[model samples]
Target chain A: MASARLPNLGAGNYFGLGELYAAWKNPEIQEMALHTSLSALGYVDILRVPAPILEEHVFPFMETPTSTTMEIAGTPVADDALMEWAVEERFVNATRVMVIDLDRCVRCDDCVRACASTHGGNPRFRRHGRTFDSMMVANACMHCADPVCMIGCPTGAIHRSVEHGTVIINDITCIGCATCANSCPYNNISMVAIRNPDGATITDPDSGKPIFKATKCDFCDGQPGGPACVRACPHDALKRVHFQELNPAGMAT
Target chain B: MIRRSALPFIVIGIATFAVVAWYARFTWLELGNPSIVTGYTLLVLMLMLGFFNIRKRLSMVPVGRTSLLLAFHVAAGLLAIALFWLHTGTLWPTGSYERILAVLFYLVSLTGILGYIILRSLPRRLTQTGIEVVYERIPAELGEIREKVEALTLECTEKTGSDTVAQHYIGTLNWFFRRPRFGLSHLVGGDAAGHWLRGPGGAARRYLNDVEKEYFDQILELGTLKILVDRHYACQDLMKKWLLVHVPLSMAVILVSIWHLLLVNVYAI
Candidate 1:
């Protein structure tokens, strides 16, 4: 039942308290206000007023009913159908869903580059995953509420971030077991062989055996203003939306 | 949310049982002849269970929540087991062909239950080990470790002018490092490799000079890495192998079940 503040209807069609008296005085303006309010409430069908009904039943009753108070009545503005569809689509269950509007997305790799640059030239997420219509929920950690990936970390290295709730692997303690990588049902986590700054494989000094660690999108936890991929999408095609907040209507291209 | 959604299904299952019980107690209808209804229900449940793989493959299509589907699949599978018990009305079948069907059915159910248990438990066991690995890449990773170990052993022999450590590695660790070993031990969470490395493998260290001892330490570290790799293979392999049992048996159950249905309709009727 979240209400949206109505934007200005048109030039000189102010519906605020400042212009309330003027809107009340003019019948044509009041009718326009009624139409706009109804439209805003998604009652477009009601606006198809027959000429006789509008002039006789509706307009005459306006003064009696008090045009000063425009009580627009219809279904609530919230799209319950869209919300239900999103939930049915499993969008609401995802923690941090990186959705791409395929229509808007030009298949440009800017988001990929942004992710790579943020994470020392290694992108944390892949560009593909399950898609519904034009919207693709890319291969990024949803930081699932029930992360199966956390089930078998012997060292307790892979854990949820206390502040942000992001699933992060503690590199120092991670034994490079790849249990988490295999456990991730979505294949979001990737096991990368550890390397020194100079690109030499980081290995035990004693054994000289190469090391590996599980890596995935951390939702750009410490980055100012949030995920670099979302920020870097020039066309606004990519967004990190909570599944619950996903608007199915917005994704309809 | 799962519990809430499952309530209706549970209620329906109870209703089905109650109806069957009432019919058996009071009605002239025979309980043995009630197999058609229950059998059909079981068949439908099996078909639903089979569709789970299809659902997984069609993730892009907006069918429904996979978690919700999985919950239904689990519940339906259990209910199907109950229906199976009721349909047969006995643990063992008398006829040979009937026995085969029952055996396949039981095997399918047993494997399904075992797979579910493993799915629930193995993740926790995997997390207990700090190392994470991709199952398919284990061989390549193991190869890298073997190469590193071999290089370390060769360097130790060259620097210290001794083949004691090198000779010991050749005799004891050569084949071990070449490929994944102690698979069954790793599967059952045994640390026999670690024990051998520390005990017999560490025995080679005493014979080595200071420089070779350093290399010995490196070889021990490589051995530890190999053990981790072995453990990964064990757990991952089991996880993958469980499906081989579960899926094919499920298919066999369905195939034998259809044959049972045809026989029941054509002759038994």
Candidate 2:
């Protein structure tokens, strides 16, 4: 979990310690410290307090519903009621995206190997491609908030699923230009050499040539437990987390 | 104001038709198959246009005209995909070169399409919510502001007898250094620069000078925000990045196109 908070940092025990030390001497940190003086006292207490600590978990209170409705079809329908009834549809616009729980990840290469095996010999998936805070992040599409890959697609071949909010590369529509491969910030998209069964490969229906498409972890939309890699992990290392729910302030406790 | 360089896309319709004609002739002559020729031709053109330099050149004149070119680029590419299918006349084939070319073209087109969506739609929506100041800009701004902030720290140090340089650096970098590249633009968004530059003209009596002045303000603001400095290096990185994708993909498109042509010729013969 701690590693997950800083996935870009890569694997190492003293990850970013040098940078952190530098930050400690920074004026912005000092200013922020001075402003949060009251909160600082509690933070100071944490240093003074013993490491092994116990705390009671309290359920947070939910804010009261402030209801508003858009007139869809000459109806003054309750928005909340309609939304509650259509929970799946509401998930279509979900802002809560997934995160990699790095601590539990063993990096055994099962996910990577499984992805390759499932998708033929193409090595589009990685068990530990990138990292954050001394933890290696297994390479998979992050399904980013603002996906860069979606930008350059001339056709709407790549789109976010309204239901899952997952970035998808529509296979049939995809023209295999490798534009998304270049645009991806995380380098998550993998190009695959697609083949057909019967020990033979196929050609693009249109171009009369082999069909290649960008493939990545689709979170196993119809498969059991979502993703095959996650499900197949022997170490139980993989789990999708809602970043907002997990880390409100982006700090690992 | 839309820059003047996007002129070619204005006549994209004519260019596209001409390219198609050229493609049809070349394909029939070389491949002896219309569909194969069309598919490969479309792929080559799409990949070429996908190049940032080419796109920039096309977008020089009128934004609308450039947009029309972009639309044609997209349409021709799609039609070419159909032509590819028609050229093959089947889903599966028994040739390696034939399949490789087709596959490469497919991937290139698909990725290009995805890129278009991100360029056209995603940026507008995402730019509205939380402006993603380029990472390059963040560091440069930090450095520039770092100089000023460090000087301020030195002044404070002289007075207070405390070496809090580190503290000050962090403080200023986080608070002041990392800022939206275009705060006002993000707030009012897109046409705000145009509005500011165009003044009250609303495109009626606007001159090239007016457009240039608007661009000047934009460039000046970008400089002030240190965006230009960041982008100076960043432009190279961006260009390289796109080149890695666009240029090679274009080459692949052309290669596959030639192969597709020859294969169709042999098949017909």
Candidate 3:
């Protein structure tokens, strides 16, 4: 019906209008026309375009645009401001970042308690870490994009989970070598000595030596609701954010 | 489902010492000799510790996790030290061969202890710096920063028509940029680069024109980045080089130990 209507406009209006109509029907002409129309209307602000459209159309053709402010429909829209708004709204970072908003935290230790309870009374992660403003990214296994801790593991005990990509230690296979503990730049992994059921230290009878195991957070693998620490945080201060999911270009206001 | 904790290790270590002490006393008093038993035990432990390197090499095989072996290796090492004392019955050995063996043993033990201390403390120290860098990438990163600095210097000299920054770079900062500098300072957590940059960079800034100042700002940023790269190198280099000391000495200890074992068997027997 739209195709039929195009010809009617040409026949009723002007002599050369038919040629224009035929040209407009071509895909290349259609794209050029759209581009010209948007440019003429001063709608060239890439940020104002919907994300999918901008990503598909503008981003590929444009020079990598420096983030700056531009006017859209008589309103000045700052790209950095848009990024900030997106970060708050969508939690975007080019790298995955696990952040805890400390201002919202009551420090009740429920998250720690929950983690310990789930992990047989030994909390995998510590509550302390470097803080920025009020946000404290607690000492937890980041399951880094490139895990150096995996390098020298003799038994391949520390590995990425196939399902979730969380770095996990095989408890059954883990030998308390402390290699992972030492290798971890964040000091997130720890060497723990294992004990027998009688509450005595398990020792090699021949050498009279204690046995050790390397331990760290596994991000609650196979748990129904994901990370117990995040789930148990009643104050909602804790969040397991992947920095990669965060829009790198956007800043959160 | 056993919980991992240090309490078990502490308890085990104390228990091990108590048992070893009791065994040494009983063997000396009742059997009229502890050296035969303790010496053999020490030899076996040295063998086991030597095997740890082999285990590390065969990482692809699922024989056992290296961590477990390392834990066993450390425990065995401590036990071997205790047994060495029991076997010798004195701090110093008397025979020339015995003394040589003693020297090698002590050297091995000292390095082990130092390595253990480094292993325990270095990670925390690295984290405190809050700069995470891969050991292998440090050189590449340093190269990139060097290139950036050189480009900025060239740009500053060309755009501003003044070689003040360029001359300053050549005179002072050239040595800093040539390769990783202040490595020892970085290892000790000293900011020699920062101090130098602030002093010299500030001094140079007064001579810079406004346009040159912009280029200088970029250069300063690159300089700061270089300092961080150096810090990464110092920390990572220490981590890598210490292993060089520990591993080779460990190998030498094993070799000399085997030779000593044969000598003891040939003469003493």
Candidate 4:
């Protein structure tokens, strides 16, 4: 594996004066020093590393120091070094969630037609919306790595699940403010006009106005077959992408 | 208050509006009328807002705001195509505007797909991390103090001349049990230079210069540690911005798509 570039602080030193001065004044430095003195006297923190060094490097390491070591390219290195090496180059990796095979699309409008049917005539919810010449693609969410929508979600309704890595909007938490819609980079999500299962428009009970909730294709997580559009498409034109399969060598893969 | 970041939104807005107007001309989609004009207006609004969401790097937006906007843009695009199809009532019509718009819409959608792929896969390749520092906690002053203690030990050792058990205890206690024991890692890791060789106090022995050299290296190591922290922060920020370019363009394409969709629906025979 290619080694990650270590931050160079030598002849090519890059930090500005302001940052250096700030570090010179960091309170944590003083605290760390005191802790180091204490640890030297044999008081151990949960980790065996001395307190001061542990505190300063805690954010970077984010892991316990293991005495265990392994050979890497014929070099016997400590476990902590190997773990840091693994995540050195890549930060937050993103996985592809949806794919549209333009080659397979018959333009039968089944996906769009199915989405419209599912959403009750609001064609705004289609898997593929079109342009003057060709078809347009649609889906509620791309589940992006940098979810701009989550930035301004006032009620914290929209969130990227840490476990599955899917961005989900908690309906009960959403206030139907449309902030997510306004901030959406692709406009895939919308403040859809909501209704009861029976097809009548759901309205605010107190305000007596039609209720709107942010809605989108959730890949039909709870459904047995997965995403409604993927399952509903007769042509198999759409599939949730797992980008890892596309680029085996890429970090996410 | 508008910055360079807001430029994409404005450009996307005007371009989408113009496309809608042009599409209206080629198709009988009531180019000069109210509902169609309103729809076109919304397309511009959507495009501008979508672009801003990305360029500003609004951290508070939901995780998939860019993706959502693209999806909505696609839907709006389809409506535009549907309107155009309604006007022409047939596909494969030999009209220049119609053909150009059709191809352009396809291109935009294709680019949008590619942008999504880039956004999803890139950041993982760019995780910025700092070096492994084992003694960043030691303040410059305290580290210097520890250096003095080590220097005293070395000086005292040389003065006493005999490497006795009592001498070793005194040296170890003076070096590790001094006012601050923070620099021991530097001592163990050989990073403390020869500061420990000089023994405690400013009183210089023959090896005092070597102890000073160790103190100097400690100063350099501390600086290197800070530089790593800043670099890590910078790389993370850069990775976030890269997504801005890839994701916002999806919105612009979506805006153009609306006009494309309307024209297709109106003009298709």
* Candidate number that wins on lDDT, 3 or 4: 3
Q: Choose 2 or 4, whichever is better by lDDT.
A: 2
- Please, what is the TM-score per model? 0.53, 0.30, 0.52, 0.29
Error of 1 at B227 (Å): 1.4
For model 4, what is the alpha-carbon lDDT of residue B1? Answer: 20
lDDT (10s digit) by residue, model 1, range B49-166: 8887665544334455554565666777777788788778889989899899999988988887876665554544554554555566788899899899999888887887889888
Which wins on TM-score, candidate 1 or candidate 2? 1
Task: DockQ for candidate 4, please give it.
Answer: 0.01
Best by lDDT: 1
| Ten-residue stretch with the least lDDT total in model 1 chain B | B57-66
What is the C-alpha DockQ of each candidate?
A: 0.02, 0.01, 0.02, 0.01
Task: Chain B TM-score per candidate, please.
Answer: 0.89, 0.47, 0.87, 0.29
Model-by-model lDDT, in order? Answer: 0.71, 0.46, 0.65, 0.45
Looking at candidate 3 chain A, the ten consecutive residues that score lowest on lDDT are A2-11
Q: Each candidate's iRMS in angstroms?
A: 15.9, 21.6, 15.6, 16.8
Over the stretch B28-95, how does candidate 3's per-residue lDDT look in tens digits? Answer: 88955656666666777788888876655433233543334555666677777877787788889898
Candidate 1 vs candidate 2: which has greater lDDT?
Answer: 1
Task: Single out the weakest 10-residue window by summed lDDT for candidate 3 chain B.
Answer: B1-10
Chain A TM-score across all models, in listed order: 0.63, 0.52, 0.61, 0.51
With candidate 4 superimposed using the best TM-score fit, by how many Å does residue B217's alpha carbon deviate from the native? 76
TM-score for predicted model 1 compared with the true structure:
0.53
| Poorest 10 consecutive residues by lDDT, candidate 4 chain A | A33-42
Best of the candidates, TM-score: 1
